[model samples]
Structures are given as C-alpha cells and as structure tokens.
Target: MDGQENEEHANRGEDVPATDRAPRPAPRRDGAGRTGRRALRRTGVILAVLAVALVGVVLGVLAGGRVSTDIGPFQADLSVAPAFGGGTKVDIPPLGALLLDSHDGPTHLTVELGALDQSRTEALLDDPASINRASQSAVDDVREGVLRLGLRTLASAVLVTLLLALLVFRDTRRAAWAGALALVVTAGSLGTAAATIRPEAIEEPRYEGLLVNAPAIVGDARRIANDYTRYAEQLQRIVGNVSQLYTTVSSLPVYEPAPGTTRVLHVSDMHLNPTGWQLIRTVVEQFGIDVVIDTGDITDWGSEPEASYVGSIGLLKKPYVYIRGNHDSGRTAAAVARQPNAIVLSNTTTTVAGLTIAGIGDPRFTPDKNTSPAGSGLTQQTADQLIGVGDQLATTVRSSPRPVNIALVHDPASAGPLSGTCPLVLAGHTHDRQVSKLPEVPGKGPTQLMVQGSTGGAGLRGLEGEKPTPLTMTVLYFDKDKLLQAYDDITVGGTGQAQVNLERHVVEDPQAGVPAPVTPTPTR
Candidate 1:
C-alpha cells in the first residue's frame, strides 16, 4: 500500500501522508464494504460449487446412458428392405460403431433405441423418468431450484449476520438458526410446488394414451405392441371415446380442375402413419376420385422405431402418386413401387389419366445430413428416403418412353429448378399447421405450389401447446388448361390424434379428359 502511493507521488510530484498522520478508512461501519465483500466471497464459493456439481451431473449422465432398458417383445429387429423406398436404397448403420441389432439381436425397441441419441434416451429413462417438465425440462427445473435455494440461503444468512453484528457472538448463533429456518421453509415450499406442477411419467404404465405427453407420441406404436402381446385382449377396451370427438373439426382441400375441376383427393406428410394409410382406402372409395397424390413424408423416421406401427398400415390402398417428405423413411414409397398403382415423382413428371403431375421430394435448401435427426429432428437414414424418391424421378425421366411428367417432393424449396417446366407442383413439408396459403413460386405453373396438409395428426404432437391440427387432404384437377377450380378445406378433427376424415370438392364436371368451368376461389 505504501509503495503504491510512493510511485504515484514520485510521478506526480506529490507528498505522501505519514503513517501516523494518514487517515484510516473510518472502519467502513455504515458502508459495510467488508460485509459486502464477505458476502460476495460466499456467493462466489457457492457458484463454483454449483458449477462443479453440474459438471458432475453431465458426466454421470454420459457414463450411465440409458443404463439398462427393457422394451419387451416388440423390441425385435425389423429387417428393413431397401426395395421399400427403391432407387438403390442405402441402409442406415446404427450409431456408426454400435450395432443395435447385434447383441441379443435386434428388437423392435432396439430400433427405437438406436434412433435416439444415447444421452437423450438415458435422461428419458431416469429412474422414475421425471414427467414434470420432461427430460430437458426437468434438468432446467432442478438447476433453477438449486440456484434459487442457494441464493435464498445466502440472502438470509447475510441479513441475519448484519443484524447480529450489532450484538455479541452469543446472539449470533440465534440469528444463524433463524437463517437456517428460512432456508428450510423456502426449500419445503419450492419442493411442494415442483411436485404439484409435475406431470406423471409413463414408466410402462399400461399406457392407453389419455393425454398429450411422450407416451401419446408413440400411441400407435404402443397399441401395436399391445395387440401382439394379448393377441389384442385390450383391443376392445373402450376408454373415453376420442372417435366421437373428431366430428367437431372442419375439413378442406386445394385441387386444380382443367377449367373448372372438383372432387379431387390430396394427402401430404403422410409420414406413412397407418392411420393415414387406412384413411386413404376410405377416401378413394367414398370420394370416387380420379386422383390421389401424397406431397411427401411417406415413410422413413430415422429407424424402424415407427415402423412397428406399420402392421395395420400396409393394408391401406396405394395412392395414385406420392412425393417424398423430409420425414419419410422411404418404406412406404418402396412398397408402393412394387405395384403399378403407386408412383413416386421426385424432379420429373407423372400423368394420372393424362393429368400432368410434377413433384420434387424434400428438395435441397440443405444437405441431407442436416435434414433428418437434427434440424428436422429425424435421422439421416430417413432423410435418405426422400433422396431415393429424387433418384427415382431422375430414373423415371430417363427410363420411360412416355413423358409422364408430374413432380413429387417433400420440400417446396427444391422445386426451384423444375418450376416453369411442370404445369402442376405439389408439396407437404409444411403440414398446413397455419391458416394460410404459402405456395409462392415462379416455377409452380401459373398458380402457386400446392401444400397438401396431413390427413393424420395421430399421436404426433405436444400436449397443451400444440394447436388442434385437423386431418385434411387436398386434390387438384387439371382440365385442358390445368387451372384450379374449387379448393375444398376438408378438416377432420376428433378422430383421436390419429384419425383422418376428409371430404372432396363437389365437382360439377366429371370427365375422363374434359375441362371444367373455372370458378374463383371461395371466401372462407
């Protein structure tokens, strides 16, 4: 301290106060810098301790990763066929190094397990598997709890210390005890609140999905396994009838009739859910439609995790045409390709009874690597399904002698190169979650690109926060001019989270190849 002032005095030609004459800092009694400094020191020590604790938690999670899991019988390996998605399909290796199907062999649950990143899966399986806020939510909750507790403890301690300082050490102990009581009370109240707000975790809770939660996300998958387990002993078990609840929603579609077209069928982002597939059978039969086009996401969800739901799904009738969706695993399209009835259009053309169709599957605004299991929350394996469709389109143009030119794709952005060439463009990645038309493209014929909404919401949504996305599909009819005639907004809600109820545009002209009178779009 003396040296600091001496250096300043030498540089500025100032005199230094002598030790005896120097003024003291006045004990800083009211200023309380000492107390403040001590409090800060305490806080810093607490924070450092907390940081180490967090690091320990992260390390523990990494080391224990889903430690032990039992997915039961459905946990069998699914022999995924490349022919399902076609176009020289490539198999997705499990975790690069680990083979999910090798030890005790591949089980259905293993497929699902293989799809998830290890850490996330482990956190989800945490003992009681916290259901309050979910895995990520629980992590955040505990962190906040610990921090608030620590802060409150410090505050109470400091305040008590300040009051106690005016007295003797004998009374200081009492002040400390009061501070401890405050911490206990605060912790108790906070703990109670956390418990009250926490939701129930589905730890294999016979899960008949009564609400929107992680369990519901895999409702179909769960149901599929249950059917096999008891030979469907609970198949007839009637809980609250969600079937009747579906009637409350509206349904609609967008289709182009030559001049004035109507009664066309459209489905998008099927993601090849069995429920949507089943609906397709009824839709074609009921509407007595000439065309059915799937915008994309027919199959391919990282792994065969969702494939377990395909038991009843494969029974659905094939669509006239399908475009690749980012989520599609390519299994649906690959299966469809085996039959002449189903067609996939990537960047090329297809004609359904001379109606020109063009589609591009999940087109390139990004690399396929980034598409699934990341930005799209899907795996690269599923994203590859869209690519297979793209390759198919490329092959269709080269192999076929006739120009069956109609493009199919999972994304609107990739349709960039083929815009002006094709008369009709169809897509489905957006899922019609919004209440507006988003088809704005220079290449999508004279009109905007068509975004076909999903016909199946199923178990695929978050609870509370996720809005009511009804099941709906659109159909476009092209007369000679290929102008859109009537847009039917077919909404189907209440069909559980998975039912799809659709209605077609009332077509005035039913023709093999004639143009319908052009009518303006209806005002909703």
Candidate 2:
C-alpha cells in the first residue's frame, strides 16, 4: 500500500524531487544599493556647489580694483596687475599739504615689485605643501584658507558641468564647452595672482637700504616706506612743539627797546643742533634784529662732515658776524665764509648796523688728528696765540676811524684784554652765561662782558648725563647812540622739546652808580 501511495504522489508533480525544482528568484537588493548611490550623488553636488562659490569669490578678489589703506602716518595704494608675469605697484602720494610745507612741494614715491618669486607666490596662494609648520602657525592658517577656497572652486566647476550636460544641454559637446570656459576663467585669475602678489608685500622691512641711499631713493622700496612712516611721525612731533613754543612766546610781556635802537641776537655753541636754526630764525624775525653774533662751537667736532650746518645761519637774512670757538675747525670757518650774509672775523673789524664790531677767533685747533675722542679744550699754544691776537685786535680797533663799539671772542679768558678797548664785550664757551662790569680803565670807559650760554645745551651731549644744561640765547638792545642799554636772555630747560623762559636785564648808567634794575617777574 506504501509503495502504491509514493508512486501516486510522484506522478502528481507536487511530490517532485527537490533538486529538480526550479530555484526561487533571489530577493530584490536594488533598494539599499540605490539609496546609497543617491546619497553619494547628493554629497558630490553639495561639494561642487561649494567649490563653485569659492572660485567666484577668489576671482572677484584677484580681478578687483586697487586697494587703499593707511599705515600709520602714510596712505598707501596698491595695484596688482592682471596679466601673468606682470608686477605689483604701490603708490604713496605727496604728503606736502599735510607737512606744513616742510618740503618744497608734493613728492610722490612709487614702488614696483617685478615678477614675484616662486616661493613667495606659493605662500600667497596658501599652499600647505610649501609652508613650514615649525616656524609660524599663521602661515599654516593662510595655507588652509587658500586650499579650502581653491578646492571648493574646482568642485563647483565639476558640478556645474554635470548639471549642464544632464539638465540643460543633455549633450556631451555642450557640457565640455561649459566646463572648459569655467576652467579658463579660474586659471586666469590664479595665474595673475601668482605673478603679481608676493610674500615681500606682507613681510617686515629690513631697512638695510636706508644706510646706503636715503632721503632720496632706496633699493628696497618697502624698507624706505617704513622709514618714511617713522620720519613723518617725528616731523609731526617737532612741528607741534615749535608751534607751541611760538604761541607761548607770543603771550609773554613784550620788552620794547628805545626807539630807533639797534637790536642784536646773540647765539652761541649750537654744537650741530638743528633746533638751533629754528630758534634763531624765530628770534630774528620776532625781534626785528639788525645783526646776529655767533660766538662759535657751531659744530660738535668741526669735521668736514659737519661743515654743511654753517650754511643754515645765512637763512637769518641778517648780518651774521661769527667768531670761531675751540670746537670749530678751519673747515668750519671756510664753510661759514661761503654764506652770502656771513662775516667771519679773525682779528678783524667790520661795521654792522652803524657800529664798529671787532672779533678775534680762538687760535688753537681743538681737534687732535690722532685722538680717539676729538679734543675740545684750549691748548697753551692756542691760549698764547689768542693773547697775541687779542693785543693786535685791540691796537687795530684803537687806530681805526671808528672806535670798536662791541668786541666779540669765543673764550672769556681772551675777552679780558678787550675790556678797555670796547664798552661791550661778548663771549661764549663756558656754557654758562655771565654779566660783569670791569674796573674802570682810568682813561677809557668801563667794559661790560656779556657771556652767552650754550644755545643748544651742547647739542645731543646735553641729554647724555643725569643733569643737562639749559639752552640759552641773548638779545642785546642798543641806545640811539649805539651803546648797550639792556638785554633779554632766553632759556630752554632740557633738550628736544622744552619750556622757554625769558629774563630781561637792564644796564644802568655807570656814572650814576645806581644798582641795575631787577628783571620784571614773568606773568606766566
């Protein structure tokens, strides 16, 4: 019965062998795989979009117009050329208008950086491979920013080409044309940036070029630009101080001299201080000075390098009568002689402002050829020569048609012999001022020695030590008869920028023997 049942089931096909039955179709796997592929496509599109946006921004920056910004005291304008292999140029317009006319006119300076170095170009591009991680982190940041921007631009180009091919053109030929045009634009911008911009543009200047050629042109323009900025700052500071000084002086009480009297400005021991020129010019114009007397030490070492400063005195537009001090060399005297308005006196007499002036320069050369530090002290030989010169000058004055009204010398020691020869004696070299009336010379009138203090406080040396002497200048007023009547002393405390004090000292008639009048107390 079992055999008969098995035969019947086999015959029915439901009982067919398992191996002979066809295998059921494999389950569908398109769902997860298709999902993954769609996710990848979305990610690529997003990346492409970001890249395209980055490229646009970068191209705009590169092809944009020039940039301008202020760096400290300077206004700088920078222009980058668009063409490959071209250069970048920086222009600094003339600052004359802002300089208070310190210069003759507006001066423009242009700096052009030719084709940039490869390394520098790479740095500007922010190529991480070219940057060193050990040196500075800023370089790394720059590189990262550049790379990120560039990658996004490339990705965008790819995505746009794909979109054009599938959505717009739906053709390979159109997609290729669109992709090529986008690449060309991006390449052009990058190429221009690489050619023009350089690392030197942003680097700190060395200023080494300043030592070689300065106040005019420079090999390294960036260094000069930096120096110019600093100079502008210093100039502004100096101008402010000078303006303040003028305002202060104008507010002080005026010292009116006798009518039709001659006024003389006495300046001494400038010691190469440029500020002295400014002060002297101011005093000459303000006082209506008829003559200028400089009892020298005009230069610090009296070297050939310092001779040029002598020309500045001629700017006073007054009769500049000069006598050499221990610090002045023959070169310095020669320079003084070149000035049209300068009168160099060496045991000679010249009439100025209707008064006979006799002067004898210090005879000894103070600068030793072999000394490490230049010598400035008066030597015995010079002292002896000074004495002889003084005697000769006194004799010459006595025999002249007009008696010497004023006697000028550098050292007070040399001024002793001129006492009886002239009523007024002016000298400098002590860096300290003094007023003294010599004993009556039996037959001649009594002589008054007015020694001026250092006009520049010994120049830069004044600021070296713990205590520095004050800068001083004197103005002498003459009576209608050309006789000394009164004088005003101007003193500036400290060096560089300082406060000015004016003191007026009167000279009473010697015959009356009355005490000299006290200086009027300053109101401010």
Candidate 3:
C-alpha cells in the first residue's frame, strides 16, 4: 500500500518524501569542482618533485664543489656550500682554522691547505725575486681556481636536479624547469658571494688552532694592510727563518727525562695575553708538567671584564696554583678559584702535585687607582709594606703542618722576608728572570729565590720599547724530596719575529742530602 501511495504521489507530479522513491540522478560534478581537484593534485606533485630535486642538487654540490690549486708553495682546496652564515674559513690542517667574517649571506667558503712543496719552500729561503713571483702566481691561481670551481659546482647541481626531476615527473619539460631553478640558485649564490667579497676581513681574522701563532704567521695587520708586497716578503722571510731554526734544533741532542721527577711550569706576568696560555699549554704538554704556578699579573687591569681570562685555568687539566699580583683583585682571585683545577693561595698553605706550597697576595692593588694608597705606595706597596706582608706570609708557612717546599709572592721586594722561611721562594713583578741565593741566614742553609720574567712578553706595554720583549717561561724539575733539581728557560720571539732560545740550569745545593732547616723569619 505504501508503494502504491508513492506511485500515486509521483503520478500527481508532486514532491514525494514518503520512503524516497528511486534516488534522483546523482548530482553531476560542476566543471569548477573538477578543475579545483585537478589543480590541488598537480600542486602537490610539483612540490614533491621540487623537494626531491633540491635534495639531489645539494648533495651533488657538496660532493663536487671543491677544486685544488697551488697557492705559493702550498696546495690548497677551495670549496663553497650553503650555510647559516656567509664567511670564509681558511684551514691549516694540524694547526687550526682562521674564520673571517667576510660577508653577510647564507653561504660559506673554505680554503684548506692540503700540502706544501718542500723544494719550493726551501728555495724560497734564498731567492728574493722568486718569492715575489710565487706570490703573484698564487694570486692568479686562486682567482682561476675559484672561477673554475664555481662553474663546475653549478653544472653538477643542474645535472643532478634534472636527473631527479626526470625520475619523478617522467617529462623533459618539467625536468628542464627543475634544472633551471637549480641553475638560478647556484648562480645567485656564487654571484652574491663574489659581489660581497670582503678583502679587508683579512685584517682582523679570528684564528683557531695554535692561535697564539697567528700574529707571527700573519704579521702585523696594520703593517700588512698598508703594504701587501711587504707583507708577502715578510711572510716569506719568516717561513725561511723558522724553518732554519727548526732544522738546527732538530739536529741537537734530545734530553731524557729523569725518573721519579715532578715537572712544574712557572709562568708569570701574563698581563691578559692569550699567547701566554698558548706557551703554557705548549710547554705543559711537551714537558709533561704536573703542576702550574703563576706568580701574578695575569691581567693588565684586574677588572671584572678581565676575570674571564682565568677561565682558561681549567683547560690545563693540571693543578694550577696561583698567587695574586699587584694587578689582581679579590674579584680576580674569586674567578681563579671558580676554576676546577685552580688553587688560589692567599696567606695560606696547600699541597699541590705532592709539593707543599704557600703564597701571599700582593699588599697593594696598583691598577685600581681609587682603592690604592697615595705617595710612593700609590702604584704598588712601599718596600716597608712589602716586607711586612712577607713576614706575615713567612709566619704562616712556619706554622703549616707540612714543610713548605715552595713560597710564591708577586713582588720580589716582599719576598725578602720570606727568605729562609721556605726552601724555594718564587716571585715575578720585576719582568726579569733572576735566580739568586739570598744572604745567608743564621742557623739556616742557603735559600733559593727565583724571579720569573714576563711570560706574556710584558703584554702591550712591551711594544713601547725599541724591540718587543721576548716571551719567557720556565720548566722546573723537582726530585722526590720536592727540591729543585733543574730548570729549562724558554724564550720565544714576540710578534714580528721568528726566534726561540732555550737554556738549561742545574741547581747544586751545598748540602744536597739534608733539607734546609726552617727558621723563624726575622722582621726587617
């Protein structure tokens, strides 16, 4: 009956809602809908294909962008790639890299030294004209190599992009489009890099690897910036001179380390020079140093800003026992104490690397004009004040539970009272190295006093003299009894020179077997 009613309604030509009479012809999709669907699918496919092509191109560029060329006597490789920052990296293998903030972009350029022509380098030592010729040749080769590398890298990218596109789309036209996009990217990058070339960045380059040697390797930036030709000549001369010196040293006899000996590296008057750390690290590694002792003046000005220099103390990985110099402050001492390997001695005694040591901070804070005293004691403490401080330190050492093997003081003047209080007294404030026996003390054997020179080449102040001061450091060897056995004094030419000298000294104690009797220091 329901079916008959529905039929009747249909016959009446009225809308029939009863039980839905046969479904109306399925709605036909409009042309607009079809077009929209097709477009969405096409867009997805295009995006996916482009992503694949980009990956392929980048891989190809990274793999094939490098070119090797001869620069002077060195063989170097030049390469480029997309990176976070636009800078140039010069890598001298086994030493370190020089990062130059050359431009502002999204790419990186690397020049890596691969090899050196030994014969050419040796010949350069004697031939002046050849050095100039070689420099010019290097410049030309670098230019050509960069050009060739760019072209080859672009070609590689385009080829890889096209191949990936063809594999994904199976159409020549689409593949060509992808290749064109890659070509634009590679060409634009190369063009941007070339346009933004910053030759002046070489003037202030950040060095890596043996960074302390940068000044020696690159020469004075101001001088070099003024005369490129002169810089090249100087560079050539340095290489030749250093090579000769190395050859001479290599021919000398190698010293064997005595067994059961403790090695100590004594560095002083760093004056916030980074090179001082370099020298310290170098000698520590070469000499197998067990402990490091710095007398003072690690900073030019003992401000909070200079405190960061103490951070390197932990990097030494060995015990670093330090005493405050006249240039240091309580803030500086706190920074040093924060280091894991650092031990700051202030009117205190402690054992380090098996040797019991005591130290006293300088009585004066010279760099802080506001806090320092007036008159002769203005820059530093007067002789009287130093002697007073030394007496206090001597009393502390005398009361120590263990015998004091070493006593550290920043000023030699103050060390006067410390004499005979300890077997060895180390000081540095004079910027000159001296080893002497203090006047014989009643009932006490001879006491050795060692004054270290500026390990930082006297810092920037040294530049004021006719010649820059040489960097000095000493390696002290102590026997099982913690007595000085011998020491090697090493002096390195400051910036602008390539010279090194080493002198060895042996300490002969009159009574070698008997320990020096500790006596109460008489007040001056």
Candidate 4:
C-alpha cells in the first residue's frame, strides 16, 4: 500500500469508506508507513518476543518451583481415601474423591506436594515399608515445576507479543512493556506469597494441625499460581467469584426506635469486602450506633489466607460486637482478639451498657487440633489449642453473673434447646441459608435469630436448603426491660432499611468498659 493509503489504514484498523472494496490495499504486509515506521515494524517483533520470553523466565524463577511427577503411576481415583500405610488420612475436598494408597511393601511414596510434614513425616519414612523419604525433594520439585510453568507461560506471551508488536503496535516497546509488566506482576506476587507462605507452611502445613484437613491447603499456593498464570477462569473462580453475593431477606424488623440508643445497625458476614466494611462504618456514623455485634467468619480460612485476613482487617475497626463465620482464618481471629479496642469473648459474658453478651460455637463442629470450640478466647487465648472450646464455652457462661444475656456464636446449630434461656442469641455461620421465621422448638423461649450474609454465603448461588447454606446477618436492639426485644434484618448486598423499636440499656462498668451482660454472648 502507498504511504498515504497506509496512513489511513494504520489509523483505522479497518477499511476506510470502502467504496470499491478492493481487498483493502493488500493489508499492509510490509512497512506501509514511513521508513522509520517500517524499520520499527521489522525490529519490534524480534525485540518484543525476546523481551516477553525473558520476562517469563524471571517470573518463573522468582516464584517457587512446582514439582511435576514425571515417572510412575501415582494415580489414585476419587473413590479412594487419601491415606497412608498406617491409615493416616487427608481430605482433598470440593474437587472430588481421591486415590490414596500404599504402594509395594511399606508404601513409601514421595510426592512433591509442598505440604507433607518432615518430622512426623520422617517418622513414617523410617518404616521399612516407606520408600518416600519426605524431604527437600518435594520442595525442589514444586519450585522447579513452577519455574517450568512460568517459562511456558512466558513462551505463550512471547508469541502473542510478537504478532501484536509486528502488526498492531509497529513498535516493540508496547508489547514488550506488556510482557514485562506481566512478568513483573507475576514475580512480585510470587515473591510476596513466598515470604508470607513461611517456613511453617513450607516445612509442613499439611500435616501440621490436623492431618485430615491438610491435603486441601497443601497445594493451594501452587494451584492458585497456576490458575492465575494465564489469567484463567479457575483463577477468577477463586478471587472474583468470592464476592458479589446475596441472601434471603428476613421479614423481622430489627428494632423499633426507643429512647437511649441512637441507631442500631445489625450486620454480619461482611466477608473481606472493604466497601461492605465501609457500609457499617457509614451506618455507625450515620445512625449513631451504640453497640455493633459481629456474628462470625471475619476472616476466610482464618490465617491461612492472609491476603483476605489483612484486607478484611482494615474494613473492620469500630466499637462493635463481632462473631465468627465459618470462613474465618486463623490470622484474622488473632488480629481481632489482639486489638486493644476489640472485645473478644468466647463463651464468657461481657456486660456492655447493662446488656449481657455471651458467645459460643464455631462453624466447624469437629475441633481440629488447631482451634478450640468457641475459638481462641477473644483472639489471643492460646488455651484453646489444648483444652478444647465447646466444653470451655459451657464453663465460661457459668462464670458470668450478668442479668441480661446476649449470646454470640459462629453457627446457628449451636442455638440448641438450652439457647433460648439466654434471652437474645446472635449467630452468623448459617449465612442466612434458610429464611422464614424459624418456629421455636417446644421448650425454648422466643429468641430472635439472624445469620449474616456473605458473598461467600450459599444463598446467591441457590437455595440454602439445597446444598450450601445461605448467608445473612441479624440485628437486635435490646430494651431497658432486659427482655429480648426489637429486631431488624440486614441482607448482604442489599440497600434499604426498616425502622425498629429502640431501647435504653444501663450497665455496671468494668475496668475494660462494662461487665458481662446478664446473658452470655460469645464473639465469634
């Protein structure tokens, strides 16, 4: 194409006017523009491709290597349980059933899956039957495999970059810059994750707390890395799909405006969203909130998923009551409890403005060796790791002498028969999975109920009763009578409010602030 004609084509990536429709001047095969432009086209592709490839290498090298199984039939089917020779079991769930078996004699199998515990793992290795040495090999394999994957990822980038450089940009720098940016992001992300993954995780996260729960988290980083490498849908599934959720709206109004309390905003399962966190902040400021109670799951996977924990922490700083959600990770629970302003009461009772607050129950009924029943009291209580939480909760409630009681917990199931005796109960584990004023079982008194909704809650995808439980948050405004009173309902991702009766509550002050209210309400 001539220079003038080429200029038009370059500016408009399509035919101009197209009166004749004459094959569009042969589509600029060679340099159609100026001599400099032509020269750029000739050199840019080579440079961009090289730059892209180089970037990929850096990314791969920076991230840990992934171990790839090359030889052997380490294949196990979904039907098989992930087990060791001695029946040590692991659960790799949400994915499906797995094939876990013992091979040959001792059934010693060395897998580069970066999670096996070497110490206890070594104990097993010593067995005459165990061939798997369970050492640095797995780490090395994962690290190497990650690098290889990075290389492959970079290779793809180079090819795409080459074409775009030669045809689209006519300058190598743009494509090279994009490629380099990808590499930089990958490297930086990997570097940060590596630092955060820690020796604890690297050494033996899988077999650490409870061997059963380890397998799923063992390959988490690697799998997340792989999915995110090519910007795959799988990556989106983890990060993107986690937010933007909905739950059923409750018919019960939280409160009827009363004298003393300014505004009572009930919220639960705010699940790691800064914007959602900001909502409570705005509401607290707007409504003049007296006490904010959190049901639970403030952190996803507790501490294991540090990013979510850190991100959510910023969103949740306020004079409020908090409960645990099933998704809460260890780090977040720890952080919240440690906060000077954070009042974390497990089964213990706290009296706030003459109101009794008590809490109990966690999302997980079966205690993993890592956490206690009601969770580490307030956050810093390490005693939970040993004595267990459920039993501890019962003991804790007995400690409190508060007249009015407010109960808090991670799950609604814990609201068993004895729950209503407390007067007011608050929970979040169910995520409002099922809606409809729950008919009180025969003996229990009338207790207001609400489960905070989360983007991670089960409701949005479908009915809570179908499979995953729905999510929602419950709010209550206690009146001066020490009676379980006004209630309001807040739905996740919804806007609008219902006015409720407000009450004036008085209290006996403790050194920390207020003594435990008559009712025990554990902060999840």
Best by TM-score: 3
- Work out the TM-score per prediction: 0.42, 0.54, 0.54, 0.39
Worst lDDT window (10 residues) for model 2?
A: 94-103
Per residue, candidate 3 scores C-alpha lDDT tens digits across 246-359 of: 443333222345788888889998987666786677677767889999998887667775787788899999999999988888898999999999999999988988899999
Residue pairs with backbone overlap in model 3: none
lDDT of 4: 0.43
Candidate 1 residue lDDT tens string, 378-461: 457655554565455545544556643345656544443333433344666666632222334553333234566666642244
Predicted candidate 2 versus true structure: per-residue lDDT over 382-469, tens digit per residue: 6676667667777877887887888888877776667688788888877888887756677877788778998878776676666766
Model 4's number of clashes is 82
All candidates: CA RMSD in angstroms?
21.6, 21.9, 9.9, 25.1
Instruction: Score residue 308 of candidate 3 by CA lDDT.
Output: 71
> 275, model 3: CA deviation in Å?
9.8
TM-score of 2: 0.54
Model 4 misplaced regions, further than 4 Å: 1-256, 262-264, 304-317, 361-395, 433-448, 455-472, 492-524
- Which candidate achieves the best lDDT against the true structure? 3
Candidate 4 TM-score over all chains jointly: 0.39
Once fitted onto the true fold, the runs of candidate 3 whose alpha carbons sit more than 4 angstroms away are 1-33, 51-106, 110-134, 137-180, 195-226, 234-402, 409-417, 434-448, 459-464, 471-524
Would you list the rank order by lDDT, best first? 3, 2, 1, 4
